[model samples]
Target: MRADRLMTIMILLQNRGKMTAKELAEELEVSDRTILRDMDALSTAGIPVVSDRGKDGGWRLVDNFRSQLSGLTMDDLKSLFLFPSGKVLEDLGLHSGALDTRQKLLAAIPGTFRGEAEAIWERIHIDSSTWRASKENLDALKTVQQAVWESKKLTILYEQADGEQNERVVEPLGLVAKGDTWYLVAIRDSEFRNYRVSRIHKAIVENETFIRPANFILAGYWEQSKEEFIQRLPAYDVQVEIHPSVMKRLYFTSKFVQVIKKESSSPDQWIEATLRFNAEQEAVEYIVGFANKMKIIAPKDLKSKVVSLANSVIDFYNEL
Candidate 1:
């Protein structure tokens, strides 16, 4: 295990130059003393590990020193070939480049590791898109990506969820792909905002470039923003008794509904479950669809709405 940790330290220093002992310890999830000992071991092992003392000083490998990829273990080699979905690569226009990179890596690594890497590639695949054939309009994705890559400003015509269109100039920070959907994270009027790529009607990459914030990490920001968005959503809880047959279906429809908690089985074999929706209307719409398969246990208003909606549907059909 120490050998793996030592090799990881070397790789880290080789990739990201000048990491402080505290930083390295934090990254490797070890104590500072352990990192210092690892450094000593690397040095004694003929590794050119050096430490500088100053405000911005840290441990670094000597100039021109690079670790060999041949030192990677079988697991590491397998990890290198763990690619995302082909659709994701195509979205980023890296499908061909990804194929080329795989070939180059296979050619570059030692012959001993090549077979395992190639085998892993054939055995493993990832598809992050949903089952439904929903396509997003990404007409502005290329221009937005270009601005993000160039660290340039972007002027976009964005359509809001309410269908209101607005034009604004923003500092293109990064683009994030959540499943098949893409979002542009940018700074507009000194505030961080997320613009759905599908809603971006037009994008113009500005000639002027802006300095990227030193502390802005795209992944971290997106995660925090996602959490905040979920927290801000309106929660409407509904208690229901679902038939045995529809229990799995309730879990499957997770996008618009969340199963907050489940109670013990009812005497008649029905399942008591607590479900959450964004609004009362959403609960009414969903519960009404289940018809007799699901029955509302509490919240008299929701029961009334469902009955009223069901009768309305019945009456409308009867008229035909």
Candidate 2:
């Protein structure tokens, strides 16, 4: 571990030029004293580490010395070649560039590890889109991307989930791709918000540039926002008995349903399970789709609704 830390220190100093002991310690999750000790060790090993004092002082390598300590492990090589979805790259106009980069990386790595890296690309593949392949309209993505890159304000016509259109002027901060969908993280009316790129019907980049917030980190903000959004979702729980034959089907339909618990049963016997949905209507609709394969055990009102809906479907078909 100490050897790894020493190598990391050398790489950090080589790349960042100068970093204070406190900064290095915070980054490496160590103590300031530990960082100072590491610096002394590096100097003793004739690494040419020089430390200066005062407010603008830190540790740096002397005479523009570059270390040849950079190396990639097998896992690192695999991670570099684990490409994201091709459609996502095309959406960002990076598909061709990504292909070129992949070729260059294959040629640049050490020849000893080349065969394993090539095998990784051939054996493993990632498909991030849903099975249904819901198409998204991202015509405004290029404009939004440009605004984010230039730190420019934008005038946008955004359509809400309820089909209401509203025009707003926002300061573009960053773009995030969750699954196959893209969202623009921006500041509107001095508050941070995420706008679905598909819902952006129109976008006009403005000439005025806004100063980005110093404390805002794109990835950090997205993670916090995602967690908060999940916490705010409504939940409706239900108990049911599902036929053993359809057990695998239940697990496959997880986009709208979550299995909370399952009671043990014989292979041919019905399995008692608890499931959760976003609302009572959704639960009823989902349960009824399984036909006679599932039976609701609790919430008498939900069972009645499901029965009524199923009968209505039958009566309509009979009339037809």
Candidate 3:
């Protein structure tokens, strides 16, 4: 752990030029005394760590000193290329920036490791889009992105969960891309909110800009919001019995179905499992798609709704 902290300190000083003991402690989630101890250890290890006193005093690496990132192994190089979050940059229309940064990284690495890193890109690829994912209509994406980067306010036509459209003027904070979906984190009425980029029909950047709060970390805020959103979502547990033939399909294909406890001992028979869904309607719609291959064992209301839909489907087909 101390080794990792020392490496982190070096990297931080290398990149940031200088940072106080308090700042380093805060950044590393350690105490100022621990930071001072780490600094002493770094100096003892022949790493030139310059320190000074007073308000402008902090820790910094000696100028022109380079680390051994160039000596990374083939696996390490491959790990660097295997970034699923690169999709986020692509969604934000920063694909060129991502590519340019990769190229620069390749140049920085030693020639021996560079070939292996470049090969990783060719051997592995990440497909972040879901099955049958629809094209996102983001006409306002550029306008919203501009607002986020420039710290400008924006007036937007946003579609709500109930499909009602409302005009909102907001201070854009950050943009988060989860797979193909994009969400704009913003401030309005002194409250933070998330707006789906696809739901934004129109966006006009306002001339006025606001000061971004110093302590607001975008990544941290997004994580907290994600947890809160998940907790707030309406979730219902469903008991289902699946035929062995479709059992694997249910487990692999459905995000709604999380196997709680498998009740089947044999491989060829019906397997009882529990699933979850955001709403009864959603559960009904998804289960109805499987036709006769699946059955809802409990939650009689959901079973009834699925039965009603299946009968309707049969009636329409019989009429033809």
Which runs of model 3 end up more than 4 angstroms from their true locations? Answer: 1-80, 83-91, 95-100, 110-116, 131-133, 252-257, 300-305
Q: Write the per-residue lDDT of candidate 1 for residues 96-155, one digit (tens) a residue.
A: 721245665664566567678889988988898878854789889999999999999999
Clashing pairs in 2: none
lDDT, candidate 2, residue 237?
90
lDDT of each: 0.86, 0.87, 0.81
Task: Please identify model 1 stretches exceeding 4 Å from their true place.
Answer: 1-67, 70-75, 97-99, 110-112, 264-268
Worst ten in a row by lDDT for model 2: 95-104
Query: What's the true lDDT of residue 226 in model 1?
Result: 98
| 10 residues in a row with least lDDT, candidate 3 | 97-106
RMSD of each candidate relative to the true structure: 14.2, 13.9, 13.7
- TM-score versus the correct structure, for each prediction: 0.74, 0.73, 0.67
Per-candidate clashes, comma-separated: 0, 0, 0
Candidate 2, residues 1-320, lDDT tens digits: the string is: 77767767776776567999998998889999999999888988899999989999998889656643258799998898998888778888875621245555664566567688889988998887767775899999999999999999999999999999999999999999898999999999889999999999999999999999998999999999999999899999999999999999997865889998999989999999999999999998899889999999888678899989999999999999
Question: How would you order the candidates by TM-score, starting with the best?
Answer: 1, 2, 3
